[model samples]
Target: MAPAGLLDAFWGYERALMANDLVALDGFFAPGPQTLRADAGGILVGHDAISAFRRGRGGAPARTIGDVHVRRITDDTAVVIAQTLPSTGGRGQQTQVWCRTTDGSWVIEAAHVSQPAAAIAAAVWRVVGSPLVAGAASGPLVGQTVAVKDLFAVAGFATGAGVPAFLAARAPAGDNATVVAELLAAGASVQGIAQTDEFAYSIAGRNAHYGTPPNGAVPGAIPGGSSSGPASAVALGQASIGLGTDTGGSIRVPASYQGLWGLRTTHGAVSRAGMLPLAPSFDTVGWLTRDAATLELAASVSVDAAAQRSLEPSFVVDPSLVALATPEVQAAFASAVAGLSVTSVDLGDPDELVEAFRVTQAAEAWMSDGAWVDAHPGALGSDIAARFAVAKGITEGQALAGASAFDGARAHLDRVLGDRILLLPSASSAAPSTTAEGAELEAIRGSTLRLTCIAGITGRPALSVPLMTVPVETTAAAPVGLCLVGPRYSDLALIALGAALMAPLVE
Candidate 1:
């Protein structure tokens, strides 16, 4: 039989975990650099790293212990095997190695946890299957699986658009969207329809109807959205390709936050038939992948070959744009840029351009969804609702003025960036804490939009390459993408260049 004191210590540790008592939980773990804790996300080494993770994680999922089994390895060392019954309906297993210290107190020296695979994560996927929609028998994309953004039309499924009321009002699509059909024809099957920000309006991926998706790279950070679902699915290895859209920074932001390669195709280069529109003027089809190779393959089938163009190898850096990122991101960018062949140039005031883009985007958003929003009151979350309120009041004169300013900015950027690639940070910072809200979230969003609007205004292809890592309070390090903005119709070439740059570093 197992010693009484060891069992008592095990139950005490469980109590501390249930109560989320950080101090008590820390004490339960054998203190030193040799301590370890691991889960599906990754491993945490040393007591300090494990402690830091616990502080940031709001708490463990509520679960009850059952079926405890014990084995004695030695007089002072034992193993505890316990079954966990999660409230969400799943059986999990946890294994721990306990050792008695000189003081005669038992503590965990190492631990590992395994949870039952969920059929679907409600926050990331609206619907899923073993193979939701099968692909063709053979093609270049054979064996690849795709996560179609909820904004896309999949045959036999109604596009949810991340709002329950909107989803309830729609009918099942008779045919797949052009992009979805192209991917399927290329031998890629659909994994499932993933979630998005409501109406694809918000960049921050928190949906009021469905919960926010988890950031695959950073355990307790918000997943960048409106392409939030697909990005998360791809990052977590649930799908090989994340078929999404980038109206503003939807694709690039999430890619940067999740350490994936994302591409925002040139406007009008890929057909958007059957897809919901947030801002048609800027809306463009895109995809996210874990590596540059998969991203290239996915883009090859969908993008128009006739529109493909080659870009000059030369790269340019706009100091004004780089200044918009956080200090940590700025430092990482500087380090990454030092090794590359790049020229410094000024792109003028970013705030002025951001303001112009915001005004026009808001107007377009109102035109696309204002009627529905008015017809169904209280349909949207507070952040998007407030944005629509401002959009509702935009005068015709203001929209025209904003359009004129945006046109001028685009023309100027086109002339300056003729054939050279523009390099900048993909986001203002690494993913923000999930608990971040109110003005703090808005400030981060505003800063990022300034950097992202450059490509949005120019109608050029932009690729977010996971080339830099920045330190964060939540983890040892978080990835920040180095964005590459190429000339119009340079989507394919952009992907190739990114893959080449990433190859050496990954090797």
Candidate 2:
């Protein structure tokens, strides 16, 4: 729902952007606005001051600015996103974010400026993730109820890897995952843990341990998994955010289908002490939110263990922009990238990297669960059985060599990045309209993960920015997501980028 009279002031912001007048842009924000960044010291307090700083950039007029789009957040606050030319001299390719003021003025909240074709998936994360590091706030996130994923160890809830037997065998845990503890310390209430796919495997939102949560965003359509339950709850508006995990497309798939922001941090940057293992190498904890700022705030709490870390922000755009998504989905992502400040890079053909990931992941799945299967063969999904079977053929030498190859890839990327973020696809498509039991389900699941598996194999940091939504022409269901992928430990960078363009990304 959009705030009443939102468009009344949109032209003002448009004029300011067209004129590249930072002063007018600065005047539009609320006092004491929160701005986050990496190397730039994450949080920016004092709305007035932040505006002054943004005005200093003296950006040029955008090449193209999409029609104003607004969503109501409160009586006075209206979240706004628009596509526009980012620079004064450049052709159309940019995105903008703004919040409405009481005086009918719109101020820039954040802006992600980039080329039109590069990509514009502002940012995407997940149900919720990573161990929450300690924070100094006086319980800013308090009173909110967060639904935990199965992997997160919650003192009394058995960590069901979506396996019923695992739940029965594992005694209730004695401690909360770091994320849960931090949220608790911040004064938040932890609702009971939610369900996920078998060990966060499938993307259909179905769980062998917990029954599938109804898809609030798309009733009959699968709720997208492996963070199935968390996304389900958030879409239903039952929880503030759902804590989830992403080894491949698990988090983003659900978040996109559910029309939420999902973030996948650079692996190793966030601690994984209390979560169940999928691919220890690639698994990343994430969170879900309806909009970008909420997603950014969640990232702020975890990036650098609650504001202890920051990095100079940089970006990467793969030269090979293959058709990874449907025509409409591609169009949406393209519109999003146009709204950001992005630089292009060549990541080459992703086929090799993606296939290796599959091999490595299977081997790992078997190592983690093959033994479990031996002990409790009855408690498994056919997908699990199939995955384990594939793992059996992975030779120890192959696994070792594969591990080395993976490390080499990560190391190479680290050198290339020198701490910048890499933008990649969240999935080949948005939420697929099929059931775990549907005829085309398996193909759809495999198809979706094709582009996202690269991150999991390398243990790199990645986040999904829910930038644009392409409405399904065939159905009444409104829209699907466009996503972003960043490098390892670039969670905060991803947040800043996402926050900057969130408004237009989702609109």
Candidate 3:
């Protein structure tokens, strides 16, 4: 039997709907693809769509629900059935499946309306929402939809960073993130905030608090994190562009996994105002799109170009780093860049480079969230908790040493690639299986970061072009990204170059 309080809540929802109170009605549904509503007029899928429907429909016929029967499906789930007597109707029925979230709030996950079936079919959408509309202005991205990673604050919404506790505790943002505001000003409609790894920590897409966002690019494969949601959303066609933050390949890794065009802008190229901090030193705003041209369009809207640099066909390939790719990836990359002139460059030991970046990033991650962890012990996912525990061991001296090493590497790269780009695999391997765990997962993270950390260490721009696919056990071939790192403040040039390089391959 459903609780008496739940029955009261159901009645409250009925009142809100009857009154056509958009704000009050919105409170009744959960905020993701898990929420669904179907009615004779049309099916309104997702919270945003439902909200929009409510706003557009205006006042509905007055109706009174009676003879309500609520059945408990579980302690946290229930079904509500009721008789609806509309003021102008013959007969009607409503059924709702309600679920209780961790915060002990009841929300409608699925709903159905009948007896007016002849009137219309239900409008359906992938269940998700946190929509914020853009101003009515025409620009390059006027008709495009951009899904923002939850780390960036959208006005009137809270930054979740994929942690339930943090989300619950945070206040609604008063203003949009700098990048988000820029996109809106450029005439792109906001699609809704997408999930991210907790505090944008892990590179694996799975969130400890929230569930993993689906990787449409690779069936049964990881959707690389912490920008997982935006990448997955863009790849899945839920949105045309995905606005995300990249701190040590968060955007690049997910883009590779989802087979989208992802960019990690030059460090400090974009403002981070109103965005949650992970590792400030390595953090940068980036985005993903299905095609190179759209990627360039989004980049143009967001990037305030420091100076334009001409695209150079000659690229420096580090064979030692290229060898890090698995046989399948190696072959795909070789084929993808077959026509371009590539010259080998000695970038030094890859393992050492990985460690240097790791220690410094770990220290910074700890610096950003260590106090919070101490305050809310045991709230983090075990994997993240374990990583932070290790991070705590990184000493000040060690961080300094790591920084020194990174500076040396950056200087070396700057000296080597005078005006050319450095070409490498975006990740050492394709997206890992969802079942991958323990040492297996960590090993993948380790190998992947070895390649991803290069851009972070140098504070330069890096673009991941999904030019080929590599074999994975779960799927026939998982998409692989070929990374191109360029000089500092050369973000626009990199995007143009990426488009030029990818056009011949994907187009």
Per TM-score, the best of the predicted structures is 1
Per-residue lDDT of 1-507 in model 1, one digit per residue for the tens?
786599999999999999999999999998987888888776677787688778767788999998999999999999999999999888999999999999899999999989888788999999999899999999989899999999999999999899999999899999999999999999999999999999988788899889888888986678899999999999999999999999899999999999999999999999999899988889999999999899999999988888799867899999888988999999999998887899888777888989878989999999998999989889999988888888899899999999999899999888888889999999999998776767888999999999999899999999999999997755667999999999999999999999888888978
RMSD of 1: 2.3
Give the local distance difference test score of model 2: 0.63
Q: Quote each prediction's TM-score.
A: 0.93, 0.67, 0.74
Query: Which stretches of model 1 miss by more than 4 angstroms?
Result: 1-4, 21-35, 45-58, 71-78, 98-109
Model 3 per-residue lDDT tens digits across residues 1-507: 786468778978988887788898989988864467776333455676566546644556788776888888888899999888877676688899988878777888888977643221111111244345664488888888888888888888888777778788989899989888888888888878888888888889877666666677654567898888888878877789999888878999999888899999988888899888988889999989998788888888767765545575668898888887778888988998788888889877889888878888889989998888878898899999888898889988999998898788878767877777889889888887666766887887887888888888888889998887976654456799989999877888888788777676555
Give RMSD to native, each candidate: 2.3, 17.8, 13.0
Taken over the whole model, the C-alpha lDDT of each candidate is 0.91, 0.63, 0.80
lDDT ranking, best first: 1, 3, 2
Top candidate, metric lDDT = 1
Task: Using TM-score, rank the candidates from best to worst.
Answer: 1, 3, 2
Clashing pairs in 1: none
The 10-residue segment of model 3 with minimum total lDDT is 118-127
How many steric overlaps are in each model, in order?
Answer: 0, 62, 7
TM-score of 1: 0.93
